[model samples]
Target: MTDGNPDRPVIVLVHGAWHRPSTWDATRAALAGLGYETRIATLPSAGTDPSPTASMYDDAEAIRREVDAVDGPVVVLAHSYGGIPTAQGLTGADNVTQLIFLSAYLLDDGESMYSRHGMDAPADTSGTFPLPENPGLALYHDVPEDVATQAVADLVEQSLLSFTGTVTRAAWHDIPSTYIVSEDDRSIPTALQEVMAAHATTTRRWAGGHSAFLAAPERFAALVDEIIRSR
Candidate 1:
């Protein structure tokens, strides 16, 4: 990152399930070099409770703390289940200028994460690791080969509590939202990603896998940079 205008603010990151704030290290370094500040948030993963007592709002409160710290409006990027928190986090955040979904799930009011895909009215409550409570698995076969293998290895069961949690506020409609769809995403099929993200005002496609930030950080960072700089 060369010297950038300090007045433009920065882009903030929110990662998905089974991940941590540290997972965005590479992307954060790339952005900071470009003169942007980034705060990568870690969500509650399987470790908090293998007993499965996590809710998306619980994750959102974690994100909201970061959003509240921004001095100016920011570009909020969410990956996978992280979008649930992002959507909810942006609700009362005056500093949140935009919401960007990266191969993520976006639901409407009263809609739980699983309900969007018709997986189940309420996600399963079974206690399992890696598979969690999602019905028949929500992961897909279209993700890039190398990325998918690592993704599988990194997989951990997300809380059934989060999947079944309902969001009262839908931030995408209120914010100038964008969608960066990964064509090779295996977890969520590309077709479904497109259809589900149709409501975003701006959408871009990338030829990467679900973990593009890990597999291709620079490219993903550049796209995020462009979004933030344009503001």
Candidate 2:
């Protein structure tokens, strides 16, 4: 309960593809306990959005607008490739106090998600893909079993162009940043996650699957609260 500040405003959560806002259920509860407000935003049609940059950026803009409507610095959180959207959307948003990347796809200015993961990166098609159009597509296989099942049920067809689209700028250049790596992530491989978060100004590690907020909500929430307190 280090959240001594009753006016810390809010922590904005941005989820990645193959998942929805409900995916952050566990973590949200944890933040609630520390006297912080939390918002989990779903990318439009994680199943159907076609252009990655536009879809993701637009979604992030909605988040930014929501945050700006508030009264203080926001703790923007991005999970997996959601980092791509958060990065591009908050390029000049001065209200953002910190950026938290949870086992996410963080890129440099002008980099694309596709470039980072590579064209051959594994896709957990168990149900992540095959939207009504690509039936049998595995989008979130690396997520835990329970999460994967729910993800398959509500997942949307993601835009391949999002991955192909490059971020025009690097927003984290100015915002203080922290990265949380799941040591046992199945989808992004902990090794690569470590490499990806190498440049983060601050880093934290937890022993859980990629969706630790769901797999181990309390711990994830505690970390988020801690970040808000420090900032």
Candidate 3:
């Protein structure tokens, strides 16, 4: 691993459902150019398991392990469904300096992602949740055509158990957090983003689709830098 600038905290990125760590390539590159080290927490719920049994708790454990590996201060940036596991994972992590929820779900204790959407938790949390018919339209609408197409093609099925699992603890409740709302997001409605943003320490609105970072990576990285520096 590259021993990055010691003065800056490592940025740990958690991608949303149906996305792999590669989805963060642009954003991570931009952050690297800005002199910050970065790491990715690959959630098991979104892996290539034919019959995925991993729950949000499993994803949370993955995130916890990632953060634990970092030796210094860390900032976790979670997108969409990634926030659910991110919250549960960092519950008692003292090295986590801040959390940035990027158009992400912010659920409270005992709340599952399904419950946040006004849907009852599934009694049987087996199988996987398939991606939408046109995931590119919903998630990367503002991104370039080729890039969006590739992203859509790379999408995977998310585990149903991940959504049905309730959060036992929320790290944001004890950690300083910033919520970035994508005003034009179609995947997660703007109104819902606003509601979730209420749980954050501060909120910022961006005029783009759900994966705005893919559309404008440098700008997104700059915003992340500003947020970190503000601390």
lDDT winner among the candidates?
3
Candidate 1 residues 166-200, lDDT tens each? Answer: 77888887888888888887677898889868878
- Among all candidates shown, the one with the greatest TM-score: 3
Model 3, span 73-184: residue lDDT tens: 9999999999999999898999999999999999999898888988987677789987877787888989999998889888888888888888988999999999999999
Give TM-scores for every candidate, taking all chains together and pairing residue i with residue i. 0.83, 0.80, 0.97
Q: How far is 5's C-alpha from truth in model 1 (Å)? A: 5.5
Supply the global lDDT for candidate 3. Answer: 0.91
TM-score, predicted candidate 1 vs. hidden true structure: 0.83
lDDT of 1: 0.72
Prediction 2 global C-alpha lDDT: 0.70
| Model 2 per-residue lDDT tens digits across residues 1-231 | 224355775788888776677777767778777777776666753644442334556666666676676576788899987888787778778888889999888788867766676664235322233233431223333446776676566655565445555677767888889988887776677888888787678888877666777666777788777776776
For lDDT, candidate 1 versus 2, the one ahead is: 1
Superior by TM-score: candidate 2 or candidate 3: 3
Error of 3 at 54 (Å): 0.7
Query: What's the best-to-worst order under TM-score?
Result: 3, 1, 2
